[model samples]
Target: MKSIKFTVILIFMMSLTTFHAQEVVVVDSTGVAQENNEVLTTSIVKDTIKVPFKRFKAEGVTAVVGDYVVLDSDIDKSYLELQQQGIGVEDITRCQLLGKLLEDKLYAHHAKQDSIVVSEAEITSQVDQQIQYMVSELGSEDKVAKYYRKDNIAELKTELYTVNRTLKLASEMQRAVIEKVEVTPEETSQFFYSIPEEDRPVFSAEVEVAQIVIEPEVNEEARQGVIERLNSIREDIVDNGSSFATKAVLYSKDGTAQKGGLIEGIQRNSPLAKEFKDQAFSLLEGEVSEPFETEFGFHILTVDKIRGQEVDVRHIILFPELSQDVIDAARAEIDDLREKIVNGEITFEEAAKKYSDETETKNNGGQLVNPVTGDTRFDLTKMDPTLSAQVYNLENGEVSKVYNDRDYTGKSKFKILTVTNKYDEHKADYAKDYEKIKALALKEKQIREIEIWQDKKIKETYVNVNEDYLDCDFSSNWIKK
Candidate 1:
């Protein structure tokens, strides 16, 4: 009876572990145990044991997963339910589990080192927004839940939070890896020239841009009044049974205000503005937070959930009042700058350095990058939304009439923008597409660097293997009998 139970458990464990040999023996020359080595797992236990495939219950593996000690057992129908979730396994034993576990640990480490933190309201806000997008794309909320294999909205949100948190960590890791990497013009040219002509790409003529935006000053009294209004709304929601979502839809003034003030999924450590994010993160689920001020305006929030510190929330935002006079003033100043450029009295780069408020991009001529490919040319849609709509109407190098843009601070400001650059969609040329090819080549080079690093890390990592099937060909270097 003892041997039979042992065999059953062993067989289950082996289904997850990579099987290296076709044949099995009671004992091979290396003294490794095998069951009809030449036979598959099913045939190995032909008559000795029969295990039913059903929903798995872990006998003792919960705590071990948290610590990264992988259980030697099936994950498909049982402990992991990978099959149930349709989560494909890459390397059942060696890579997938360890990669996922490492990503979790690394996110924690970076969050601490960088003081990255999240608030409940922020996550709630994110969840609400994601729900909207998913609803739109899938035709309805119910369909989204069905597509995700969730029984309802709550479960679908739970899965989204889990996926988003991991993705945020991965982004942080990639950013860390890429930040210090530098490419020279020579290297760029070399990479560009190396691509086969037929496979070369035509990069959009995108500009790399930077700006320091400032909002017209708001009266302190008016700002305070807005705060008081938000405080009263929040207090009413908390103390009474009033629905926060209903009020948000009616009163919120942000882009997403119409549909219950939900923004898209906001993961922990998301790169949103500092002040607003802080205010968003401080609330608890289903609880209305106190009115908080960000550059955007007075914000009141209600958190929907908190999953691993990534939250989803709904918020009502009211921007501070900027008089029409201030808007005209900003537009006039930008027009003066454009006139100087049109007259050739001052160059765009000089104007950016001397007067353009956007801090990051002024030093060079105002250029924008395609985030998807880091290219200078962009499709019209890639431009700052208000700017994009306006610029698409003008030919290249034309300056626009005075118009308003909502500054990052959430205050309305006006500007006279130029269709400063343009590119035609054409076949890739080494001269025009060099930078694009260079980046791709550099990424491949970095992957090679990572592999070398991985080889060393795995060798030093303490690993052990089952005493049976040691001679089977394994994918990773760490496993030997």
Candidate 2:
């Protein structure tokens, strides 16, 4: 999802909106190892490449908040993958990588200059946890160690953590800018009512609830069995030195297995729902992890390099089956929660913990998140038809009769929903718009502050620009004019 941004930019500055949790790899500006002596080619998948370090290029710029912006997310791999996926375009992918890099450098520089610190200790701790998580996802430490070509799985983690932290700090700075904007009652009311009646959002009674969920415990023996199976397969691959992709097609359980288990050109830290993410990135090239475990089950990993802004990896995921007896026990428990809530013995929130399907929702009282937006609020149209139908009919405190729901794998599961809160549609009132108004107002103030600082910095810094780029269109008149 894209966030609102208002910043002045130079000709070289790029802008990108990333998929959440996708890792945004930052390039080394101080000195990227020089590439082959040949001219950089903008076309072809593997252009006889010999490069010391990765670099990005983009074309067709846009202006955002005075910054010459572009999107250069994945010039090479994105294009090849998109073409495979039936998306054809050159400049589009070209800009994607450039935009990501520009934004990364700009905000990262500001964070360091402002002394927004991410401590060395914090980075090290996060790296350690990440290594363990990778081991878990790969089903064992050895599986991870073999894939990365590193002596061990823990090497260079501090380096990765530092880059990750830099990006994190930039995000916080962006949030600070947007969250502080101040908007008044008049502004909110005017912005809201100014829209046509037909366009005004029809708000149904919407309930916002928080929840914590714990999945049912899978039998330990069953989990161990899966890990053992994976270990044997990994042994076969290693012993024979067989092609990993070829083996993945034959044995990998993930959907991408048929394609040799390769997932490429994806941004870093993207919320690809699986504990395998940490494991996938943990290995250095040519290394593998032994069998490890996660919420999804067991897995083994093979990590490629951090090429350009993306990392390539593959995995075999193994999930254990819960017996019919386990399913019945969980369902019966959830049913009992309904009875207690019906009897007024305890609040639905209370029963959620002591009873109910304790996994995936009880922590926040069985509330479903807006999966698409990660929002609690959903217009009926944006909701799942079956769930929305039930929600519309049920009054507050009403527990839905057991209905069908699908887990990530599209497997059918039984679920009960409760309508905990609702807001009816009405014209926007300033009193009710405090958060939004305050946010907008604060943003405007931040831009003013930054603008003042930027104007002063531009005037004071001893900067020089080559003639061709000096006249290039930019967000601010920061270059020598």
Candidate 3:
């Protein structure tokens, strides 16, 4: 139990750790190229467990968790994955990796027993996205197949579907186990204090920032120019018998341009701007639509195919130009607002509510929340580089000069930021860091729930450890004999 406890704790910590996003090459013992793997996850269990099966040769079954078999190669591949993820696996033995794999298989096996259904469409969509990403990265579908050692794209997709389905099942089962678990304020306080004074987590310097953004106004001429450009593109496809994809390659501005502006499996409720979806759904097969304006830019769409409630479509986006005068006016407007706040004539939050153009943050008084942590405070060490550079030297309540920036869609905007609050590096405090502590407590509670669920499920299920792994110190008892 002590060994198993260590394994579980390590797994939990690793699950919380973020991994590097760079591409990783997976090789064999002799350094021969086997597969090109991506950093699908920085975690230990689910994402890291996705082993490229291109040239994999199984070393026979090492254990049986209900209906699922754990092959010896699974442990080997997991070790390689951890190493590639920059996790030091020297201290992490095969027995431990196997233990994790067994746990995953057990979860997946019972997910079926518990009637947790992972939709085939969802799994297929995930596979398609994965393949598409790989193709874009590796340059071609053939290259992607070769990188994975698949004979063809079809083989790669088939293998990927199996891998994705199993992962989804395991994930769903784990979610089912711990979904209801929660931590109370008392539990959070207890968890924080239970740690020895010398061992409590240290927090880095953090700041809460607020901002007001102003986008340059587009003149009628610029708007009409973009609309006319899109109309011309639509005409070329509909009238001149030109290829929409070729036109997208020659003219579109969005990231999807490389894929000929293709967007797949778009439901009516997809996160695209409402106007874009409205135009998309209105178009008949092969019928190109007139230009439509969305927040990103102007677009003209053609529905390549429609199946049920989903549409497979292609479209091109073109951003209207902002005149220098309008751009200067936007900067001047924000600059004036900043001066008023600094002179105490208007509060920053008050000005933000009345004038900021960013809808997401404006209602919150322009308070920028950390998207990752759902908190207003951002740790300096982990802050976005561009944002850190902007506010690094700011004192509490000090407003920054107007700065130029681009939104996610690359639309230019002018903004001024203020560090509303700043905290120097310090040891964790109960009241000061209540939210962080509560999150930690909740995660610990969830881990315990998963462990408890595994214990009960392992006993009821017919789990068999091969003689080779019989000596493994698994947290859950899998060796019934």
RMSD of each: 13.6, 12.6, 5.4
TM-scores, one per candidate: 0.49, 0.51, 0.85
Per-residue lDDT for 1-481 in model 3, tens only?
A: 1223655565454322311122432322112235454222222332232333344354577888787877766666666667767888646766777777777778789999989977665667667667776777889999887876678889878876776666667777877887889899889988999888888888999999999999898889999988888888888788899999999988999877887988887888788899988988888999888888887888889999989888889999899987889988998999889889999999999999999999999999999999999999999999999999999999999999888998756778999999999999999899998999899888888877877887888889988788866766666677864
In candidate 1 the C-alpha lDDT for residue 414 amounts to 50
Q: How high a TM-score does candidate 3 get?
A: 0.85
Stretch of 10 with least lDDT, candidate 2: 25-34
Clashes of 3: 0
Collision count for each candidate, in order: 33, 62, 0
- Cα lDDT tens digits for candidate 1, 1-481: 1112221222223322211111210110111112332211111132222333332223233112111333323222122333223434332432333333333333334444455544434445455666776677669877766655467778767755643443344345434544566777787777666667776675554433333233355678678878888877887788787888888988888776686876544565677666656755776667777777764567887777766646667888886665677766766677777778778898666776777665455555555455666555656545668656666767666655656676554667555555566666667676666665666666655544444433444464444444432442333343523
Candidate 2, 1-481: lDDT as tens digits? 0122323331112222221122222222111112342213243232222332344433322222122232232234333333444444443423333333344444555665667754443344345555555566668766655443345545445444655565555555454444545556676556555556565443444555433232344677667787788888788778878777887898777777766777654445556645676676667887778888775557787876666555677777766666777667656665666566678887878766655444666666666677655556666655667667767777767776765555765333555667777767664444664444444444445555555644554454433333323333334453536
| Global lDDT of model 1 | 0.52
Report RMSD for candidate 2.
12.6
Top candidate when judged by TM-score against the true structure: 3
Candidates in order have lDDT scores of 0.52, 0.52, 0.78
